[model samples]
Target chain A: MSGPAVVFDKVSLELGGTRILDNVSFRIESGALHCIVGANGGGKTSLIRSLLGQMPHSGQIRLEGESLGPVGYVPQVLDFDRNVPMTVRDVMALLTQRKPAFLGSSREHRAGVDAALKRMGVLEKELRPFGGLSGGERQRVLFAQALEPAPSLLILDEPCANIDEPGARIVEDVVLELNAKGVTVVWINHDWDQVRKLAHSVTGINRKVMFHGVPSEVLTWAEPKAMVS
Target chain B: MNTIYESIRLTLQGLAANGTLPQAFTYQFVINALLCTLLIGPLLGALGTMIVVKRMAFFSQAVGNAALTGVAIGILLGESYTSPYISMFSFCILFGIALKYTQYRTNLSNDSLIGVFLSISLAFGASLLLYVSAKINTHVMESVLFGSILAVDYTDMNILLVVTLIASLVVLPLYNQMLLASLNPSLAHARGIRVRLLEYVFVVLVTIVTVACLKIIGAVLVEALLLIPAAAARNISRTLGGFVAGSVIIATLSCILGVLMPMQLGLPVPTGGAIVLVAALVFVVTTVMRTTLSRFRATGV
Candidate 1:
């Protein structure tokens, strides 16, 4: 199914009497690989949170177009303890299976989960305890979970931050493959090189939209460097 | 219920007559206590896994202590001193919900909020106990603090059975969703799992179990049963299933032995203390086992 277009109109977020986002407005076309770039603590993540309805924000945020299906999210980091006995496969089952994760991975979703893992090149680590995985592997697993049941709209928070170059390639390839199938991919990134190299369109945010256009049109580094710096 | 009890009593009597069973098995209170354990042991163990996973050990403990206020309020408000099920449950549920609601509204760390609530409830319950103490046997108050398996009766068992059924039905099918919610609320919400509702369900589940088992596990030490067994299971477990299973086994054995061992040895130990001590022993043993296993792996021996 084709993905939906996203529209954010005059969205403003305030937390603890401090304005985190100010009248952020942008549109992401359907099937577009949209990159949102910004500096640390620059309201990029807050804008995503507001989009996901996790934060109470003012103004209208709407998904436009047909077949608006389930949203797939991969947060920057999973806030789990080091001692939990959850394995990589267990995490997969936790996201996909109807059975309790304690019962182990279910039969119906196992093949699909394995395929997703194999695509990310970490299928060998399926049995490894989630706490034992490397940061890169954990990030890949986060990316893998967004595939099944194959989300039409995938929201990724720094998907390539912890991964090395080859792992980043795997992510970029998979994300582009999904985009080719009309999936709307909203990626929050810090790497300007990646944004210039890959994104269909880019939005630079620092409490508001710093800049927005296709990569060719907005590749000027001065504005983004100043906004992010 | 009486007929069921009579039949079990008769069967135990027959075993005693045949010299195959201890005479304690035929006693009414012993049978009631065992039945209570059979229901509560697994429930506490299962819920304990989620409590540990969610890092809500202190929250569960606070709810357990709220049972003291529940009982004190129940007694003063003209509920039966022997079985104050209604008041005890409602008050504890209110306490649990209010605490959870306030958690989201406040900037205080969860521990601080829980500590504040715990202190107030204990102070309130203790002060009220003075007024209610004159109307009931001091033994009832002692059991409320430290628990007494021997104090359970047919009515208590029936209440426990219904509660066990309700908690199990809600928990079993939704266990995965609830875990998903606790582990990552945003993911669960994205998955359309109703994270907030599942959280409320868990709080109520903990509250009812705490209130229901007050007479057997006591207000002061009840969370120990919920935490220790799950912690022990976590020590050696390599997977979620094994963790839950190990917890349930440790808890069931602990509860049964806690009640029976005191009687078998003619010791005057309180049921809650015995149960927690047994679970604590298991926790220590598992911790040692895990350390040894890791050390051996490190040495490649």
Candidate 2:
């Protein structure tokens, strides 16, 4: 049961005649919060997409010694179709996948959803329309939705992009907390200060993996200015 | 002049004394019309919410139009309209699967693909109708072109009910996944929500509703039944659940009022057209109310 949480070997991706990620290789150990920092269009998203099996790429990604299945995904921000009205509880209900043929969602399922929302600090707002939530609150709800399944690996892309400083700090705290509980985290962020503070390991990419190790080892003040600044 | 005035007074009295029970209650024809509305009411309302939420109103219309060829085939083969469900379901499901599989492959958007299939199917249906009219009762063409709720029988009623229940069951179980997928597909996909499958399911559900309820709504205006009420509901609600619940209420009211309109007023309107007109009216009223309320709040007068 103990192995690298994620292993990406010889991953190469080409999109529209440009190499998004060329011959990338890395292995993130279990319980490590690995921050992926790169300049815009620097293969960070592509690499994550490949990991999620969204993009067509040639690579072998393994999770816990097996082929990487669908990992839990949290996006930078949520843009929903406003026509469909939905409350936070309704969205949480979606996570239970309750079928009508069954009697109903078990108490355990409801408890799990309640617990997850509480953990994200949006329990009271569960009845609120998901559309009405602020950007940070929506991110937490999305995080709760992703975490409800207790995914073995969590993949987030630009989670703090549009939020204020306090919101970003909340997200950072949540990520660190999840990592502390032994959940593997792969995060993409433009914020180096937060990344350096929270990330146990870091990978800098510009269409390829530049470095992979402790955050201090990979992200230096000079040379990789595109990433740090 | 005195006699004419007396006649006008008599008419007004009779109209007022009709007991506020819309004219559709005046005769067996009216009763049948109401029954038609009752049968298709909740089904269309529910489907409307799903359609608006999923943004598949156009897709449903395309599938509804495509069912014309199936109906033509059923009637041509000497089978009743009841027999068309087989062909219609198969055709719609095939179209749905095609839409789902080709979604990511082509540069043309989903609606464009739907349009392509829709036009092709309509063309095929028109030719089929023409060919069949040459062999059988020409009136069959009228039924397919418009709709005939007067012809609805116990079997049709049963079909509509069954379809409604099944659709509700299917949708309720996967409501969350469907909602998430509809709202933020990329996020849903990343969260392991099986976005493609849910998309396929959404399409298939809309297709089923189209074929099942086409007898009441017809091909041309089916999308209206699926959009108008939901749109009207959206004017008042801020959340997805509210929208869906509000859509059902508005749709049900529209159905009842729509049926009542033609009967009570002797409007000579097709029932399908009446329903759509009522739904449109509801949307207008709600929109006006919303605007007025917002303006009042802004002005603080």
Top-lDDT structure, candidate number: 1
iRMSD, all candidates: 3.9, 6.3
In order, the B-chain TM-scores come to 0.92, 0.82
Candidate lDDT values, in order: 0.83, 0.71
* Model 2 alpha-carbon drift over 4 Å, by segment: A1-4, A14-19, A65-72, A95-129, A132-137, A147-152, A224-229, B1-36, B73-83, B295-301
True contacts kept of each: 0.56, 0.52
> What TM-score does candidate 2 reach?
0.83
Query: Residue B164: error of model 2 in Å?
Result: 1.9
Which regions of candidate 1 deviate over 4 angstroms?
A: B134-139, B266-268, B295-301
User: For candidate 2, what is the DockQ?
Assistant: 0.34
Candidate 1 recovers a fraction of native contacts equal to 0.56
Tens digit of per-residue lDDT, candidate 1, span B1-301? 7789779878877897787987678677877788788887898899899989888888866876777778778888888877878888988899988887887788566678889998988888888888887887756666766776787787777777888999989998899899988777777766778877788888899889887888766766668878999999888877788889988999999988988888788988776778888889999898788778883122111
Question: Could you say which candidate leads in DockQ?
Answer: 1
lDDT of 2 at B107: 52
